[model samples]
Target: MAALRPCTLLLPVAALLFFCAAGFAVRFPDPPGAWLLSLAAVAAIAAPPLAALLRLFGPARWLAALALLSAFAFAVESLGVATGWPYGRFYYGEGLGPLLGGLVPYLLPVSYVPLVVGAVAAARHPRSRPLWTLRSAALLTLIDGVLDPGAALLGFWVWPGGGPYYGVPASNYLGWLLSGAVSSAVLVLLWPRGSPAPPALLDGTLLALAFWTGVAAFGGLALPAALGVALLAAFLARRAGIRGCARVTFLKKN
Candidate 1:
């Protein structure tokens, strides 16, 4: 972590940005392209983990393992979606349409990119383990399970064939274990560098985006899905120390 100053980290980040732009353009083309194009795109998604790994572990060790596993899982998932391979039993709805090699269809990882990044940052920060768990759980539930689906409904994105095979895509959430627990743990293990924290207007915006998009997205398939998410967020916030619960009780008293 000490070696990860902004100046030194600049080049890898620039490369990450470049690859993401190139990958997104090709992989998620307006009409999408052949499997080769999709493969390159899939490969590009590995950039963040790769970049972070380089910074964290620097030549070798645990971060490399996480980055490698993450890339492999992403590869399998992208290929599976493209060809309807191994876990091809499910389907997303028509609203999502056939996306770029089926990769663009789920659009789950976009939301999760920020989520896992934030989670890692938070966990690595000075905080109690239980508090981190509670915070992380609430964050994941809202960001991954709730907000992402909402965006899919608004034409922002869609899960055309995201059949909830036993609740959520086994691939997406499964990779999260690598990102949240394994990757975070690895970072902690290697370096304990702490820095002045940055503010989060963007984070707040993402949360709002998740909320609005979730409402818009889920309201399409089932209004109940939307309403239920709203209620759930309220409940979880209360659980996490948000203080609006008493308002309901006060209203009832009146």
Candidate 2:
């Protein structure tokens, strides 16, 4: 109990650090010290939800869940590399830790797993699993809109023959939709029944949303910023409505 307080306090601190690192990285072209800082920020962003998962689901289950997510993302990225069916023809840039088989980054899961978990945890659709899955997937896709443009501008990745959306190809979003749908569906179905998602998960999502939106706006990427703001508003409203409904049900039962 005593230890939890410091750990709990770390969440906001880490989140703030992430925003600073991310902002510096995106604002400057390969800023010195930004790559390592960005890597640390990724870990910081992932830590809160991960800690929550460990507490709620136990170590074994949490590890298993992470493994599943990592495998799925790696598989999809590998396929993208080989086939170029989804995400169009693009290749990674430097400073992203290490690569698996010299293909996808070893830390690819660092970028994906927590986002999926947070989106799944934040989604509210009590009666319809399909709706819940779809909502979470959409949220995932929308977030990429905010992130990919900044990354592209920062030279983190290159879309050779960039089509639209600030050098991001349309197919990239299509890939995200397909991958997001599958990942969210699997996580939602396998999530334990009657276990509420921790607030840290929501915090993680909100922090990502705000920082990305702010960065995009500052960098003059208007479309992604607008989309981020709009999606965030809708997401918050949907969650509020779901909570209201749940409260009504509880009251009626009482």
TM-score of each: 0.39, 0.82
The clash number for model 2 is: 0
Task: Give Cα distance to truth, residue 170, candidate 2, Å.
Answer: 1.4
lDDT of 1 by residue, 1-254 (tens): 32333322432354344434433433343443333443343334334333443444456664454554355445655665566554442333333344445464443333234344434443334555445544544444444454444434333443455646213455555444433454334334444344321212013222333344335332553542454356444433332342221121111232
Overall local distance difference test of candidate 1: 0.40
Residue ranges of candidate 1 with Cα displaced over 4 Å: 1-112, 122-138, 151-179, 186-192, 201-208, 211-254
- Candidate 2 backbone collisions, by pair: none
TM-score, predicted candidate 1 vs. hidden true structure: 0.39
Error of 1 at 13 (Å): 26
What tens-digit string does per-residue lDDT give for candidate 2 at 1-254? 22233223544464455456556656665666655755775676676667766776787788888888899999999888777867788777765656688778777888678788878877746678899999899879888998888777777677888877888888999999999999998878777777766555554565566667666766789998898788666645544443322211111232
lDDT of the candidates, in the order given: 0.40, 0.71
